[model samples]
Target: MGGNHTQIDFILLGITDSPCLQTPLFVLFLLIYIVTQVGNVGIIILVRVSPSLHTPMYFFLTHFAFTDICYSTVISPRMLADLLSEDKTISFTGCMMQLLTFAFFAISECHLLAMMAYDRHIAICHPLLYVTIISSRVCWQLVASSYLFAFLTAITCTWCTFGGSFCGPNSTDHFCELFPVLKLVCSDTHSSEMLIFAFITFNAVGAIVVIFLSYMSIIHTVLRMCSAQRRARAFHTCASHLMAVSMYFGTGFFMYLQPPSSHRSLDKVASIFYAVLIPMLNPFIYSLRNRVVMGSLVKCGRRIFSCWQHRSFLSSRTRTVHLK
Candidate 1:
C-alpha cells in the first residue's frame, strides 16, 4: 500500500498448480485440517475440564494448543480451498492479514515453549519454591508477556513487509509467506528483509537460550537427585516438551536460518508440518504418555455410557407403564 502496489488488488498463489497434484493434495490437506482442529480443540477441552491438568504446565499447554489451532485456521482453510480452485488467488489485504496472524501465533508459540521450559525448570530445580514462584499471577503474566511480545513482533514485521512496492509480480510460487512475498516486491526490500531477519534471529536466539538454560539447569538438578524413580519421573515429565521443542524449532530453524537454495524443495513441506502436523501431534505427544489425561478420558467415557444407559432404561420403563 505504499510504493508501487496500487494496481495489485489480488495476487495468485501457486499452490501446486499441477492438475495431477491438486485433487490428492486437496484431500490430504483437508484431512489434515480437520485433524488439526479436532486434536487441538480436544486438548483445550481436556485441560479445561480435567482437574489434574489445572496446573501451570497445562495452563501453558492450553494456550499452546490454542495458538496452534488459530494459526492453522489462518492458513489451512484458505490453502485447502486454493488446492481445489483454479483461481488460487488471495487479495492483497488477505495476504497481509495472513502474514500478520501467522507471525503472531508462530512467534507466540516460540515464547510459550520457552516459558514451558522455564516452568519445567522450576518444577525440577526449585520444587520447594515452585508454587510460590509460579503462582497463578505469574503464569498469567508470563502468558500475557508472550502474547505481547508476539504482537510487537508481528506488527513490526508485517509493517516492514508491506511498507514497500509490489509492482514486480502478482503471483507467489508458494503460499503467502513473509519471505516469499518479500521476493515479489519491486521496491528495494533490503531494509525490510534485514529487519525481518533481525527480528526472526533475535526471537529464535532468545527462545533457544531460554530453553537451553532451563533444560541445562533441569539436567543438573535431576542428576543430583538420589532416587532412580524420581529421576525417571523427572525425565519423563520433560520428554514430551523436549520432543515438541525439537520438532518445532528444528523445522523452523532450517526454514528461516538456512540459505534459500535449501528451501527450493522442502519449503512447502516444512511449512505444512509446522502449520498442520505439529499442532495435531502435540496433543497426542502430551496426552498419550500422560496418565492424568488417560484417566480423565476413561472417566468421561464411563459417565457418558452410564448416562445413555439411564436414559434407555427410563424410556423402557415409561413404555411398560403406558402399556400396563
Candidate 2:
C-alpha cells in the first residue's frame, strides 16, 4: 500500500514525452478536423430546420450527426494539439477524462446506431404501425436514454478501471485509451482488464447483435411488401443506416477484439479509424445519401445566402440614410 501510494504520487501527469511530428500530420489533421466539424454541424442544422426530415429516421440521423461531432470533439482536438507540441503529453486526469468521454459517446454511438437500426426495422417491418410504434415521444425517449446509458456506463467503466492502481510507467504507447492505459497500471490488472473487457464486449458485440437482428427483421418484413417503390424506399432508408453501422462496427470491433498478440501497428490503425475516420464519415454516410437531407441542405444553403443578401441590402440602405 505504501509503495503503491508513492508510485501513484510520482506519476507523470502529462502526455507521452515523445517528440512531436509536425508539418504533414498537423496540416492533414487540421484540414480533416475542419471538414469534420463543418460537415457534422451542417447535418445537425439541416435536419433541425427541415420539416421534411423531422421524421424518426432523420431524428436518429440527427443523433448520428451529433455523435460525429462529439466523438471527434473528444479525440481530435487533443490529437491536433499534440501534433503541434514537442511532447504528446496528456495529464493523468486529462487522459482519463478523454478516455471516459470518448468511450461514453462511442458506446452511446454503438447503442444509438442500434436504436437507429430498430427505427429502420419498425419503419420497414411495420410501416402501417410505424407512427404508432415509434412515436415522437418514443424517439425522444430513445435519444434521451442513449445519453443516460452512455453517462452511466462511462461512470461504471471508469470506476472499475480507476479502482485498479496505475502504479508506474504511465507511458501509454499510442493515445488516450482504456486498454492501453490499463496495461500501464502496475497493480494486478488481470481482473480489472477482464471486467473492462466484458463491459466493452457487451457494448461492442451486443450492439452488433442487436443491429444485425433488427436489420434481419427489417429485411424479412420488407421482402413481403408488394409495391416496388415501397421496397425501394425501404431499402434506401435502411441502406444508409447499415452503411454507418458497418463502418462504425467494422473499425471498432476490429480494434477491441483483435488479439493483443497482433502487431503493434494494429492498435494505432484501429484507433485512427474510430477516433478520426469514423467521425469524418458518419455525417456523410447518414445524411448526404438521403434525398430529403440533400433537398434540405440546398434549401438551407439558399436561406443562408438570402439572409446574407438581405443583410447587405439593409446595410446599404442604412449607409444611404446616414449620408442623407
Candidate 3:
C-alpha cells in the first residue's frame, strides 16, 4: 500500500485524501447537471413544438440551449470521474481534445450571445427596419458564422495546444486544459501559450466589445424615444439579454484574460463557473426573461397535459365499451 501510494503521487497529483465534504459537493453538482440538462432540453422541446416561437430570436435561442447542454456535458462527466480517480493525469491527447472542444463551445457561445444581443438591438431600436435587417438569409448567415468561428477556434486551439512538446510527466492539475497541461511540459511553452492567449483574447474579447458597442448604440437610441412607455417597453425586452450577456462576458473574461498563474483552486472555480453553471443558467435567463419563450413553455405544458387527459379519457371509454 505504501509503495502504491508513492507511485501514485509520483505519477501525478490525485485526490487521495479528499475530505467528506467532497461527497456533498459531488451530489450537488450532479443535481445541478440533471436540472441543467432537463431545463435546456425542455426549452428546446417547447420552442420547437410551439409555432409562436418559430422566429429568428427563438431559433437562435434553441441553438443556444442546445449548446448549453453540450457545454455542460463536455466538462461535468469528466469532473465527476476526477472526483473518484486516484490519478488525475489525463492523456496528453485527451487534454488537448478537451481544451479544444471546450474552447470551441466557449468561443462560439460568446459570439452567439453577442449576436443575440445585436438581434435584440435591431429589433427594438429599429423596429421598422428589423425585418429588413435580420431577414431569414441574414439570420442563417449569422448562425453559420457562429459555427464556422467555433470550428476555426477549435482547430486553432487544438493545433497550438499540441504545438508545445511534452517530453514526460504529463500530469495536469484540476482537469484537462491547455494552459494547465502546457505548464507540465518539459519544453519552453511560452511561445505556444502566447499564441493561444492572443487567439482566445481576440475572439472572446472582440465579441464582447462588439456587444458593448451595440448596446451603447441601443442605449442612445432608447434615450431618444420621447415616450416613457416606449422606453420602458424597450427596456423590458433588453434586460434579459443584458443580464445573460453580462454573465457570459464577466465569467468568460475572468477565465481567459487573466495572467497564466496556475492556481488549481481557481482553475476548478473558473471551470465550474463558465462551463457548468453558465450553461445551466442560460435556459432560465433566455426563457424567464423573454415573453415569447414563456408563452411557448406554457403552450407546451398545456399540450402535454391535454395529451395525458385525452389518453386517459380514451382508456376509460374502452373499458366502458368492453363492460357494455
Best-performing candidate as measured by lDDT: 1
lDDT of 3 by residue, 1-324 (tens): 011111112133433246675577678778889989999998888877888887777777878888888878877877766666655656555666677777777777778888888888788778899889989899889988998888897787677666645556656555566666656555566676777788888888778778888889889999999999989988888887788888878866676677677444565576677777888887788788888778777877898899999999999999999999
Ranking by TM-score: 1, 3, 2
lDDT string, candidate 2, 1-324, tens digits: 112522232132222344453566768888888989999888887877988888988788778778778878988887777666656566667777877898888888888898888887787777799999999999999989888878887877776566666656766644567766666666676676667677778777777888889988878877888999988988997778788877888878777775433536456767877778878887778667888788888888999999999999999999999999
Pick by lDDT: 1 or 3, better one: 1
- Quote model 3's TM-score: 0.90
Instruction: Give the higher-lDDT candidate: 2 or 3.
Output: 2
The residue pairs in collision within model 1 are: none
Model 2, residue 171: displacement in angstroms?
Answer: 1.2
In Å, residue 161's CA in model 3 sits off its true spot by 1.9
In candidate 2, what residue range of length 10 has the lowest lDDT sum? Answer: 1-10
Clashing pairs in 3: none
TM-score of each: 0.95, 0.88, 0.90
Clashes of each: 0, 3, 0
Which runs in model 1 stand beyond 4 Å of their true positions?
Answer: 5-7, 259-263
For model 2, state the Cα shift of residue 310 in Å. Answer: 5.1
The per-residue C-alpha lDDT of model 2 at residue 146 equals 81
Give me candidate 2's TM-score against the actual structure: 0.88
